[model samples]
Target chain A: MIEVRNVSYEYIKNSPVLDDISMTFERGKTYAIFGPSGCGKTTLLSLLGALDAPTSGAVLFDGKDIAQIGDENHRKDNVAFIFQNYNLIEYMTAAENVSLTEKIDPLPYLLQVGLTEDEAKRPVLKLSGGQQQRVAIARALASDAPVILADEPTGNLDEDTAAEITKLLCDVAHENNKCVIIVSHSAAVAEAVDQVVRLSHGKLQEEV
Target chain B: MSIFKRAWTYVSRTRKKTASLCAMMCVMLLLSLVGIMLHGVCMDASQNLKEVLGGYVRLTYSASNDREESVLDEALAAQIAALDGVADYSGISTYYLSAPDVQLVAGSFAGQPQGQVPRFVGCDKSALHENFIYNSFEVIEGRHITSADEHCAVVSDVFANLNGFTVGDRFEACLDSVITQDEAMPEEVYSLEIVGIYTIHEGWEITPMTPERDIAENFIFTDMQTADAVLLAEHGVEKPFYRQGVIFTLNDAERLPEIARSMQNMDGIDWENFELVVNDKAYRDSAASLQMLEKLSLLLVIITFSLSGILLALVLTLWIRERRHEIGILMSLGISKVSIWKQFLLETAIIALVAMVVAMTLSVPCSRMLSEKAFDVAETMAQSQAEEVHDPMADVMEKLNPTADAAVDVVQKDDVHLTFAACITIVLCTAGIITISVTLSAVPMFRMKPKEILSDVN
Candidate 1:
């Protein structure tokens, strides 16, 4: 489970981006965080990813504050991130990029992500947008992390690819028994998830 | 994956970037090697020149004018020569004589003294030794007149040939005291053996004001004892022993004044009546020119190092900026800032290794040519300036030579060859500079937080 306890963030003093936000995400569930632009959706993700610290309160993973867990251990052994731009290493082949995260065959994961053996062997840049996104998801899944954090994973994908990615993310949460939290501005994305949370103007609340 | 693998992949996969980086490192290292080689050659040459040519001050006292004073003579010069840093010395007494049967091949013989026979001046052993030591005069036949020889002479080649005189030939010469007017002075016609024959390579005329200065070709060199014997016989109980002026040479000409000052503190020498005159033009010129070359080489090294640092930093910084997305992605994947930095530095180090190899190969021949060319340039600069700019070192050389043209030959004979030590030094220095530049360039990136770097991804 991932928990945000009275967390607040601000780039400048006296001007808060995330204000006393609180939430809990359990395993075997997918949660969509929907918000307007500049509503601190990415900032919350950065906190959960241990890339930054919340100005106040704490973010916890499995009842332990991320600050207490140490940054590298949390990111490397606990959480996996999927970026909207499909942040794959440009020079590395799809298998190599997937292999960067964890010690695995990577070919099996690439095939599971619907990638051909030939496409998986080539550089990530040689793949299409949807194909490259699949490589990023494969890399995330290859890590044995129980929690997955994604920022606008389908924002750069077409409708069909986006639906496919959503289904994959659901499977990762439901079938693999992982807590998957996604930050997006889309209402349809929120409706497809197990739980819907809206971050409106620096405050978070669950939709009825 | 491992840091080494990531670094290797980055280096090999980015061909254009790697090539440009390697090019920058090669240029910097080559320039540094050249600087080291040139500086080493110049320093070595300077040291050898200093040893061959000494620097010194001449001390003399006036006997004619009442106001003129300089409490100096052979004894005092000996004391100074024995002082810590003195290298070599010569004390000379010059006397004019009129000898029958000796050839005067120098200038017009004019009249008097049988009106047919030639008369030559007498030069002491000290004078002969000075000229011989500098190669101004070479004893072509037989040996030189040593100080132990009381009645001996080394005739000049021109005079010896004209008079049909060789070694072991004896001749008569007369010396007149100042008091004697027309009266025939005592017979000091010491039948002096022609101990040696010398050819005057160049003449000594350090003091240009005196028209009758000691010229190498005219003087019949003898021992001081013989000259004094002639002087005493001619004086006829008027004077006992005459004193000669003292000249000294030091191991380092630059310290002439310092040694002179140290000598002033010695006992039995009146500092008020003496003034030390140093002619260190030769030493100073060579020393100064070498110093200039050294400083120039150092400046070149400094500028090259600075420019290399800036250029490398710029190229690598741009490289880092271009790879910001990768950095952010890596950070998001939990690679840690330290790992990223290590990989980056490792990448640069591999490129530097390749460049160092290229630079070392090119540096060997390149520095030799540059060092030789640099020597020629400095020598040419010395030659180009006649009077508007006078190099004391060149002037001293010219004065020692028979003709001024020989001095130019002296300048030309200086050669600079590369050495193993120079190459080794260049390699070490190149490696040090590249390593420092890489480390310093990474400092800024290391201080930045991963979140700060990852912000660029947005």
Candidate 2:
């Protein structure tokens, strides 16, 4: 579970990217943050991942303020992130990329994300875009964190591949007791998750 | 992960950069090695020369213009020898010899006679002897004049060969002054036999007084009795002559001036006709050379560090810039800024260590070669200067007759060794350069925010 109370962020003062935003999500559920470009969706994901702290108010995880948990350890032990470009280390193989934290065997998680053993061993650069995305997902899963924040996770894949990635994310949330929050502009990606939180003009509104 | 593993991974990934760093290190190390070797050789040469040249003072009597002018007597020589700080003392007497101007003749002094020549020296017999300071002479053939033999003489091998004389061969020598009809006036000619031959072979040509006078190749050595007899015969005098001066080798060179000053003021001595000269100019020259070596070594270290710093900085800056994405990823993975900085430093330190080992291995032979070349150049220059001063034609003529000359004995040879302290200094300097370069290169990486780095890459 996570909560945002009157949170605002700006890279520079007088130029706000997120303004007075408030939201909450329950545990063991997938939430899709749907927004057009420049709606602070990625900023919200970064805040949730503890990569950056909100300038005012708080972003809370499991009813405790993340700012109090120490950002580095908080990110290390509690949350994992998947980026739009599937930021796998280019120098490493798929398995190494998936086990970025090196905390567990990434093969089982890669298999759960629909990658063959041979594919997992190959360099991530040699993999298809959808396969690389699955490897990124496997990395997040392998971290054993309860929360996964994916920013535009299916942005580079075809419709069928995007659907498969969306199903994989949903399966991780429902079957693995994870809170999977995906920030996306795609309507199909939003429909695949358990719930949607629409963000526009620095405000969050829940949609049925 | 271990720092060593991280360092190895980075170094393995950047093979080209590692190679370039190694080359630079090798060059720097070679220069430092050359500096160290030169310093060692210069110091060794100085110490060798000092050991061979005895102490600093060259004590001798001043020439008398009047009969009343006093020469050093036995009592005076004894008194001076009793002075404190006197390490050793010796006396020598020299006289010109008339011999046959023969070519390729040996074992006999039979040929056409040459005119009498002038010879200058101090007599070493009775109280003071030559063996006390035998290092001043080099014997190429036969042996040194150890006792006061009335019939024995040690002639230089160069003079003996030119005049066709050998060991045990008899030859006639004349004194500088001979007594004529006038009892008050003395003439300069007498005859004696040669018994031994010595050589001065430092290879440095002796400078001549005139273009036509020819630098003398003739050298003769004899006991004080034979020398005294030859002088008595040349002067035609019945009165015994005492030595003009006593040569003292002091226990320490620093005491030379003090002892000389004290001897100048001793009672029963003629201060006007007696002078003490500390022959420390050679020591001064060697000291100057040592100082120059120190300056050159310091300059070399400065140049090595300055150039290495700039080069390492440029290369490491590019390396750090190339790894910006990795830095961002690591930072985002919750690796602390300090840890990231440490990794980069560890990488450079590993590469530098390998380079230092390789460079040190190569420098030994390279430094030796450089030292040999430098010594050769110095020797060549000394030879050329000697040649310019004493032309070969004049040298040959002087070889027939030597007069009013001071012979130099060369005993020291070339031997140099590198020291542990010097090697340590070189390694420390190299490590310092790397530390500074690493710190400077990491500045940009440390200044960046993780999000900024990631966004820039994206």
Candidate 3:
């Protein structure tokens, strides 16, 4: 489980992007942070991903402060990020990108993500937007990290492709017993998740 | 994936950027290598010119001067000869005398009957005389006069032929008769043995009125000690009273001033009556051009290094900026900034190694051709100016003190070789340039956080 305890962040001195926000995400469940464009959903996800520090309070993984675990170690061993636009290493093949963590054989994960053997061996940039998202999903799944953070992972994909990518994230959460946190502004994306936390003005407005 | 594999993949996949970087490095390294080689060649040529020209320093003691006479003794002569870079030295004194029984060679167009006097040139070593140094006279038979020889002379082949004289023959010469016309001074005629015969070169006669004493064939070479004895017998003077003083021939004329300064600092030397004359004017035309080339080559090296550094820095800065997206991707994948930096460094090292090899291949022949062209220009420049800057005063000094200020011919040819030291210096410089450029270019990239970098990627 990952916990955010009164975590507050600010880009500038007097303005808060995430103000004293608290949340809990358990393993074997898919959760969506649903908010409008400037609601600080992504900032909360970045704090959980250990990409940046909070202005006040703490983010903890399994009751221990994430800062104590070290940001690089937490990112490397605890969380795998799936960014918008696929975020694939352009020079590498899909299989190479999947095996970047070097912790697992990427073929199985790539096949599970619905890519063919031939598509897995091709450079990621040569694939379509949907196929590229599948590669990003395979890369996140092949990592040994216990948490998966996807920030608008399917924003660039079509409707059907986005649904497919969302389903794959839910499958990774349930089948691999991992915590999956997806930050998105779409109501359709929030509908499929196990829980939805609606954020407004850097605070949790509602939870369902 | 390992950093090495990542770096290799980027270098191989990005063919255009890799080639561009390699080409820029090649241009920089090639010019630097050539500049280093040219600078080394110029320095070597300068040293060789000094050795070939072989300037001399003459220490003269003048009685007419206001300062106390610093008479040169045997001990002082030995000390000056022992100075560094001194190749040889000679104590010379000139005398005019007439050999009554012997027939002296006349000028090409003998004008005055009073030109019957022959010049007896006395020296510690006749082989170091200016006539031999300038190739004006060469001993064809017998041997040259040395300090060990007593009352011995080396006459020209023309005079020997006219007098039917040979080596081991004796002749009677009287300096008192020529100096004072004193028939009452016991007719101090000295019997001098002929030890050598020499052949004079053409163009020795300056004009029809050239005195027999000025004629090359009428010049007799003998020992300084013998001439001092004759002077003591005639005017009652002691030994070591050298009229023309002593000339120290240096191995390298470029060190003449240094040796002169050192000589002046020696103990018991009179500053006013004593004079140290350094004569390298004959070599000035050639040495000047070589020195100028040396300075120019040094400037070339400085410019090459500066421009190469600036160009490499600019190229690398653009290269790193173009890869900011890649850097963000790698950083988000849990790779440390240090690892990313290592990848970039590896890429640069690969390209720079290839470029250095190519530069080394091209530099050898290119530097050789460039140095040869520079030398040819220097030679032509020296020759053209040598025709205009004839120093008659130096020539007169040479005749008066034969070993001092002897004209030396400029070396016409020199070959450039790449030295190990120069190669090492160039390699170090290239590595330094690459390292600094990479560090400077990477500064902006390293300063950004992974979040900032990823957000900027579009």
Candidate 4:
């Protein structure tokens, strides 16, 4: 489980982006962070992924603050991230892109994420938006991290592809015993997850 | 993934950029190789010249003085010979005289008796042979003159041709001096047999103050006994005398002044009538050229580093900026910053290594061309200077000894190695510059937050 305690984040002095907020994300569950634009959904995901520090709070992974656990070691062993717009390296093949996070064989994870052997070997730039998204999902899953933080994972995909991506994330959380956090504005995406949290004006509240 | 795999992936992926970097590295390596090769060649040549020139001492004497009264006396010669670090010493006396009638051609020496104008050279024959001074003589007809042949002489090809004489030819001519009542009286002369004929190689010819004077055609050689005999018969001298000047060859020319001062203070000698001259110009010129090369090499190295650094910085800066999105994606995926940095550095090192190998391979021709050009310029200048002075060919021939010949063997091999090492050094230096520049450009990325890197993409 990942825990946030009185977390506040600021880009500049006295200009906070995330106000005092506390939340818990349990293992073996898919959680969605739904918010309007500029509601700090992405900032929350970044902190959870250990990409940044909180201004005055604790981000805990398994009862230990992620910051005190060492940023590099925490990121390397505990979390994975998937970005919107399919952030696959253009120069690398889909399989190579997926392998960027994996400590072992990436081909099986690529197949698990629904990429054919030949399609996975093609350069990521040559793949369609939907296929690229799957590759990013493969990369995150291959990391074998306990927690996955994804920001707008299906932002660039069509409805069918978005549904497939959401299903994949839900399956990974429930079947693989992982905690998955999806930050998105899409209501469809939020409804597909096991739990949903609504964020507004730098504050978080549980949804009914 | 392993660092090797990552490095290989980046290298294979960015073919165009890698190739461009390699090309730049090759050029730098080639320049360095050429510079090193030329420096080696110049140093070798200078050393050879110094050894051949016998440490920069000139032999000179006054023409008006008699042989016995000259500085070439046995006592002074012995004193100089015994001086510290004196390699060897020899006293040589030379003058001109007419050939005998039987040996004389119609236009030779204005039809005087074949004057045995012998030069009195007092020297150890073994030292002269070891130095290769006498070895330069190519005996086309008969044998060389030995100390055993006190009266025998070696005649040059030019002298033999003008006199209509051959080896073993004995001739006699009048020694009578014509008396000009109001002017001067003619001196007596002697007859001698030509025992040998020799010719000097073209490169060995010495250019005299008079452009038309050829030493081979004009001079005849014999021992001091013959020279003393001729002087006595013609000028009526009994005791042996010498001219005012003496030429000393020492182990080190830098010690000449001290040695000269010591000689000047010797008992019963006239110091004001003579001056000592050390031929140190060759050494001085070589030293100056070496100093200039050192300065120029330093400047070139600094310029190369500065220029390459700026270029590399610009390339890395733009490249890293373009990869911001990738950096954010990778960091978010749990790739450590240090690994990211290593990947970038590895990519550059691969590019630089490939470039260095190519540059080294290409530098063979480049270094050869540069060395040849430098040699040509040196040769031309040496030739022009030779033309302005005394017989340049003779000067070169006299100086071409065993020491220089041995030095040449060493130079050819060492010069090539030196050039290759220089090329390697330059390439390594270029690699260092690239590393520093890349590291500097990567610093800003380390401080950036993942959101900041990803915001642009959003």
Candidate that beats the other on lDDT, 2 or 4, i.e. the better one? 4
lDDT of 3 at B338: 77
- Ordered from best to worst TM-score, the candidate numbers read 4, 3, 2, 1
Q: Chain B TM-score for each model?
A: 0.66, 0.65, 0.66, 0.64
Two-way lDDT contest, 1 vs 2, winner: 1
> Deviation in angstroms for B162 in model 1?
15
lDDT tens string, model 2, B203-281? 2344423211122334445566666665566655344444444567666554567888877777877666766756544
Give the higher-TM-score candidate: 2 or 4.
Answer: 4
Evaluate model 1 with DockQ and give the value. Answer: 0.45
Ordered from best to worst DockQ, the candidate numbers read: 4, 1, 3, 2
Model 2 TM-score (B-chain only): 0.65
Top lDDT prediction, candidate number: 3
lDDT of 3 by residue, A1-208 (tens): 8999999999988789888988888999999988788778878887898887899999999999989997778888899988777788888999989887665688998898778999999999899988898888888888888899998887767787788778988987999999999988767788889988888887875575
Question: Which residue runs of candidate 4 sit more than 4 Å off their true CA positions?
Answer: B53-55, B59-70, B73-122, B125-270, B282-298, B379-424, B456-458
Predicted candidate 1 versus true structure: per-residue lDDT over B13-75, tens digit per residue: 888989988998898888877777677777766665555455556665544423224334445
Q: Which should have the higher DockQ, number 1 or number 4? A: 4
DockQ of each: 0.45, 0.35, 0.44, 0.58
Q: lDDT values of the candidates?
A: 0.72, 0.64, 0.79, 0.65
